[model samples]
Target: MPQIILGPSQTKKIDGSVKKAGYAFLEKLAADDAVPGLHIEPINGSADPRVRTGRVNDFYRAVLFKVQGQGDEAHYVYLGILPHDDAIAFAKTARLKVNPVNGIAELVKASEPVAAQPAAEAAPEGGHGAGGAAPQPPVHETEPAAEAWSLLETRGVDKEALLDLGIDAALADRAMEATSDDSLIAAVEAAPQWQALALIDLAGGKPVEDVRADLGIDRVELSGDEETDEELLAALQHDAAKLQFAFIEDDEELRKAIEDDDFAAWRVFLHPEQRRYATGGYNGAFRLSGGAGTGKTVVLLHRARLLAKRDPGARILLTTFNKVLADSLRTDLRRLDSSVPIASRLGEPGIYIAGVDSAVHSVIQMAGSEVGAAITEVLGSRSPSIGGRTPASNWLDAAATVPDLPEELRSTTFFQAEYSMVVLPERITTRDEYLRVRRPGRGVALDRRKRQLVWQVVEAYRARASVEGSIDYGELAAVAAAYLEKAGCGVVDHVLVDEGQDLEPAKWQFLRALVPEGPDDLFIAEDSHQRIYGQRVVLGRYGIRIVGRARRLTLNYRTTAENLRYAMAVLAGGEYLDMEGEEEDSALYRSARSGPEPELVPTDSLGDGLSEVAGRVQRWLDDGVAPETIGLLVRDARRAQELVQGLEEHDVPVRVVDAHRDVRPGRPLVMTMHRAKGMEFSRVVLFDVSHDTVPAAYAVDKLTEGDRADALLRERSLLYVAASRARDELVVVWRGQPSELLP
Candidate 1:
């Protein structure tokens, strides 16, 4: 077997190429590298002594390292792939070495060889490298090792300690001095992108492990009697957990990635910030929140694997809000570990993976409730709606014939809060029970007479549901939790909830009922900014406490800087809060990649709207973007349907996605922005963003002054979620007058 470690650029290309080409290419490349008899091309003046080249195909060549081994063992490190001449040119000048401090190998570009200074040339007066007017004097060049010493000297930053820590004192100094913060606090805040331990630790007051993990600087201990190629290659390849670079250790792992065309798994690896959450220890309930692409889901997957590994016989329940997301999690889990059995039944032993509804249904069934059919199933599947139309954000659709419904109590938002926050939570059944229930978060106060009328409305809803064999989702969870509280053991040992922000209080209560209160019993990953369901659940209210154990991840792995900025800009100046109502922190939230700024094009005419978008899609296809990598999002189901029809009419194959989509990749995906949560793609086109369609009028029409502001914020959040789904490219098209959301 050939050992090939790819750099970021090469890894990116290979990952993309593999998705397009399949596993046969990788198998061939590995086989080619194993043959020593092949004539590997040598660069004329390589900076890296081991640089070599080999043919990948007729038109392609690979640059690699022919690392000579101690005795008979040897291996190759894949540097990159390029056309023949370019491969040779890259190898000729690429300098390679292990960072003496960080212990990670890096490829450095050699400076162009300088011609010897002309013997007759006078030395500059000011400094050797100075230019322009006559230089004044010779000056000692400052070594980068003193970087920290110069800049941080006045900020109580210790220079000697950094030098001892193997940080380049000069580079550290320069980076710090370059930062705008003169004070230690401001300095750390300004320089989150860099890895300066002592200052960072002091600023954040974080524990040592977290600081090291964030810095990606593990204690590296290198030794004398440097091993030969076999030993070095063996260590580098096998112990990639510590290496800056990594090679494929299990061919099966590589095959699985290729088979699924999941290029994400083929990347260099998870960043340390992500890895820390995956492997961190938590005392009680743990919650992690981050914007999409920050690897919250990745951490949950890895954490599930780690927990399963800790105790071989552990019964873990990996769950989320919906079946599609649950299925996605299950798929990623299997990729992480094939042997770990996936329990088909909710309460079956081993790892029981399920959507919240499935698990709740199982709980109800086991509790002998013999649950009634949901109202939607009887009334014909209805999306959550307000005024019979499903609003893009958090509008509950529940209608029942109540005799003389109080004129003041017809608001769908009012009823949703009454049911989720007041009635079911208090387990109120009768009119008197409902009257006594405290509606804490309900803003509109009702007098005793009005409250009596509200109770009448609540009673009528329950009676109708009971008579029609109709039970809504919240009822299922409420009944199961009510049952779990009085009888039977909890369902699983641990509960891991993804997209926690979408979960309501009832669902949280059910999740709480499913697990015993203990250390690491409940794990939650959520970002309230993505809460399209309009569920603002303060976890602490539901008995799941993660106060001090909460961690925030700010670095985004998906969505480029340009796209991220555009996405974030939509929600900018909007007050988004955590479930707990604290202002969500996005200050450090940043992207690792940069691309062309998002294009917000307004169609000149209504007639050209759909056709213009179709033309843009074709252009992307011509640019070599796979149809599966592209997505189309609209504000509502009406527009989603129209967009899909428009694409098909234009001869563009398009898939209309819902929560239960099968996700056929080669077709452009079109869906309502609401349905695009918890999903991502390489390119996203958001169109039909008209003012009337965006902040659905009826949904916010009944809102109070304070409530209206929150409604608009939620609408912006929906757009933010849709826009952020695009990893590299974002095209937003609007017709007529653009939505007020357009800046």
Candidate 2:
């Protein structure tokens, strides 16, 4: 049987009519690439004999490279679709070969010089033949000349080494010619996966041997001296090569890659580094940290599938900080492979997906009559509550009743942190326990008298909750953890956590207690820079140690380079710490795509800002961007509501996302910054981010210097999350002076 290889650059966007035609084209190739209707003809005067043009229809043509494998079977690599003349022109100047340095298969244009065209800034199309934009030229070809300095040359990476990394010969010259980091990255972005990564590391001063180890080069046969059919096939099988080329094994997989908009290429393709973490064996708990869009969640989902498939009866719990994100994980897991077993409940024989709180609540429900005993075991006098969560107003009421409480300790912000960081996780029940427990990450220091007053506030808060028959999620998780610890820690064989940075220590304890200490026991994916909820936490304190088992992913697979820069700029000079308290930086983070610089439109008034946003959104809609894929994010619910009314007044369709985070169809989405977490859009407008609006006066107004700093950091993170949600275009509109968070 013949195989059909799909390239990452299959540029035609997928829509209903195009999808039908794309399926017809793929089905013909699957049956036989030689099918007469495809009109697979060799390009005249092409440098490589394998280069051919195939007809998808009269309006579209596929550039292909025909390679014959073992026996009489032939495999055709589908490069991309183009118009008739363009396809022929591209085929004549393209060649497919095994990347000699990295041993991965790659397609490169021939050495024959052609006029360089300006690259258009746009989002990548999801599938085949729907989007109307033509493929843009490689960045290096279109980028203007730079100065005399070279990023790789300064680091002693010569052209020979560049070639050894499998960069195309022409791109290798461009890489060496690059004067600045931006130009170098633009050049590397045009290289194949392993090659680009090698360039990034080499330029970052990583030794060549270390780069080789990072690529797992020992496993692949590398030789630039020869090219063969067997080598091409083996190169195609290499994990890094799979990022740009997928060899479909079945019709269902084919449909997913070519038909479904929700089906991302990353689901089928894995970078070598990501593949290592996803399938590699770890002796204990492992944590994967990366900047936004760096494929951490991708690794988590793949790892869950691997564990479930490795052992049919494996009980795996895949969870996150909230219900919405956890629900997204479940959906992505199914989209990754629907056949992966999904358990109906905890401790079952398949992967169980839920929010950490939901998972804890399930433990309580499972415990039933025994849950009261578990709660008593963890919180001493506190029994399980039936009134659900104690509301925010209850905290203010509790703080007011406590006499002589310091003004700094009187706010709901301080009390919530005090409870989550020291009280609940430390299992503090009495005043003495609260007074004695250490608050490691808290910014404010408390002496004996201050501790005594803080304890009074804690006691009053608990009393109020007890009288109302309600408890916070922190206590709920603590109770669940105590129950699981007593139950002997095999509730699930493996626990996978996403958005691990946003989780409080109590939730971490619950997760640690859910899985036993052993190989592949716990897998966590987090980005501290994206942490917008809760306070800083140290995982080691919660028994989830990842001292040597942690790795960072730096390449962003989502947002464009221009947008990523703007988003990262939002965090400039702000201190961000990982789950273990070490300061974190995204210095090495880079994006795979490039687009227009994020627009910052400053207006004299709110009405003007709204008009500017509505006009841009209308233009995007006119350009064919889907309405549901356009997000109008703000810092508060009031601002979000204001955006809905403002956009509607301009005669643009819009809808406000409710508390459920339900994104309705056929309309632009208006959501608060916090609600935008774990969501992405084709285009995003951050509406009305004025200086007074962003740190959200209520969040930091009445807090201490230390508490104010923490609140400010969370506010910055909120804006960062909102900015990174944009996949292509990002616009920041301010009513007056811009937020200090903006660059």
Candidate 3:
């Protein structure tokens, strides 16, 4: 059967009405032993021996070429798709040949008037279309192109390697012309992010391993089948099953590939650094942490798929922070697994995917525990008395009323910390452990008698909650953890946690108890800078260790460098720590591409800011960006609702997505920064960010004096998460004084 190659640009153009037709065309081509359609014709001047254009229909045409294969054999490669005239013109000058070094094809112009040989690497859109202009080569306007750099002489790169590894014609020529490797490196850096990633090694004399290590390129491809097409990018790539434009093996594969993107499979192919996360073998606990857009979720999805595929019977628990993100994970996992059952229940035989709360609840139900009423019903009711009859006061106030309480422990604040940070997390049901515990961060120490009185108050509070049939999420997690510990940790073979930095001590304990301690036990993807929840957990304390099994992805694939720079500045001066209390460095984190700087709209008043933001939202809609791909994020629910109301009043289509079920098309998504975690958008508007609103005074006032710095970091991290959500553009609007966080 004839091999069919699909161009990246061709795949990109296949959407909506043309989507079905495009797939059908591929199906037809793949099924036929010979290239289908009598419309196939050759252009007069094409240099690629196999350059041919065939009619997909009356309007669309497909361009393909040939490259040397096994034993001087040849195989046809799809170049790209274009309209009739454009296709003919593209066929007129387009020349494609395989690159020896990368083993991918490059688009070399056949008609360019140049003193030097043309660039062998594919230019934008798989070598500029007829109407497009190819990139110009470096000038020595008068001199004939300097002899191309010799791979054998410059860097000991084999000139005749079995798998193609030839340097670019233009890049080599430029490299040969340069007096130093530094100049070559500078020139290659000017290429697009993806292109630069592939060509950075062309600068001979620069330690290749050092460059790869610097850029975190850990993988060495044995076969080069990745697309050379410039227009198509593997999204959330790590799972090779969804490479839409890579290559067509058969009709069945083509169908699956097209459908993968039609539904927006939660991210596609993982980057080199991200691939280790999915397939790497570690001795014990492994943690993958990176800034937003670094493909952490992609790694999770692929890693889950790999584990399931490697051992179908192994129980895998893929979990995250909330139900909404869990739902999102489920959706993406389905796209990756396809055949395996991904259920939410913990005891099921297949892979279990859910939020921490859902997983703990399932564990509770399995163990026959009183999971109790919803947290809202419990927190909202008065039956669970803290101290007085009415439930107006917090748990701390309820503990304060025990008579003869030690002077050091009488305050509500102390009781709250003693219970949550120490007693409950430590499962200190007895008074002795509470008295002896280190209480590391807690400044005040308590004697044995004081601990006895505090334990009495805590017991009374728990008894009241148990009587009311109301248990908080923390309580449920604690119960589940204790049960799993006694039962011996065999519920799941592997536990993969996403957004793990936000998990509290109880939740971490629950996870530790759920998975047995083994080689592939627990995998966590967390970014401390993105921790909005006020849960400061040191993972080692919970028995999950990641000291040497940690990798941080720095090259961001989603947002532009400009937006990322501004986002990073928010967490710049703050000392961010990992889940294990180790200093996590983000100074190396950077974006792969550049775009216009973030737009900041400062208005004189609230109404003015709202109106300005609404107008900008309208512009994004009019610019062809999908409404569903745009999001408006704020610091709280009130601000989000207000913005949604204001935008709707201005005739902008907006939807409030406070839950997984709330996502819908034809409207811009609106939510608080807290709700927007684990989500990304093409365009984002972070409005209502004023001095008082960003680091909301309410949140600040709640933190203790020692935690004031942590509170500030949390607030800044919120802004970072919000800003990084914008894939293409970010617009910030505020009234009076704008957020000082903006760089």
- TM-scores of the models, in the given order? 0.78, 0.91, 0.79
Query: Looking at model 3, which ten-residue stretch has the lowest summed lDDT?
Result: 231-240
Q: Cα lDDT for residue 654, model 3?
A: 78
User: Which model scores highest in lDDT?
Assistant: 2
lDDT of 2 at 20: 62
Q: Tens-digit lDDT track for model 1 on 1-743?
A: 56545433332345455343334445555666455434466677777677887665655566677776664434566554577677777678764443334343444444422111111332232111100111112223334555534334444444333433333333234334432222332323212122332344423234434444565654344454333444445444332223244565555654554445353342336666666777777788998888878889988887887788787667789999888888888877787767776777775666788889889878866755232222222222322121122121222222335445554456776677656776766666566666676766565677777777777665555544545554678877876776676664777887788988888788888889888888778889999788877546677888887778887877676887678777877877776778666779655466655567788888876457889888999999998888888989988888888888887788887888887667786788888887787788888988878776777786677765545666787788888999999998898888777877655
Q: Candidate 3 regions off by >4 Å?
A: 1-7, 10-15, 33-43, 66-76, 92-98, 101-195, 198-253, 256-268, 369-393, 399-420, 441-457
Ranked by TM-score from best down, the candidates are 2, 3, 1
| Number of residue pairs clashing in candidate 1, backbone atoms closer than 3 angstroms, sequence gap of 3 or more or interchain | 20
Candidates 2 and 3: which is better by TM-score? 2
- Stretches off by above 4 angstroms in model 1 are 1-45, 50-76, 80-85, 110-213, 216-244, 256-268, 335-340, 369-408, 648-653, 704-707
**In every candidate, how many clashes are there?**
20, 3, 17
- Give one digit per residue, the lDDT tens place, for model 3 in 1-743: 55555433444455555556656665665555255463666777775555787677788776766443442333445654577788888777775533323322344556642222122333332222211113444533333348444332465543122012233344434434444333433434432232344343333233455444433432223233433323111121212212222445456555555544533233333445566578888788999888898888889888888888788777899999998888888877776546766754686666898889888877866765232232222232333322223242346655665878754454444555456567667666555666777775554555677667877887677666646555666766776787777777579888899999888788888899988888989999999989987446788888888788887776677887778877888787777888878888776575655567798888898789878987787777788877899889999989987887787788876788886446889888889898889888988889888987888886666444555566677888899999999887888888999876766
Off by over 4 Å in 2: 28-63, 81-89, 111-148, 154-156, 188-190, 204-207, 218-226, 261-264, 383-385
Tell me the tens digit of each residue's lDDT in model 2 across 182-252.
56667666555566666667776677777777676643344434467778888888776777788877777
Candidate 3, number of clashes: 17
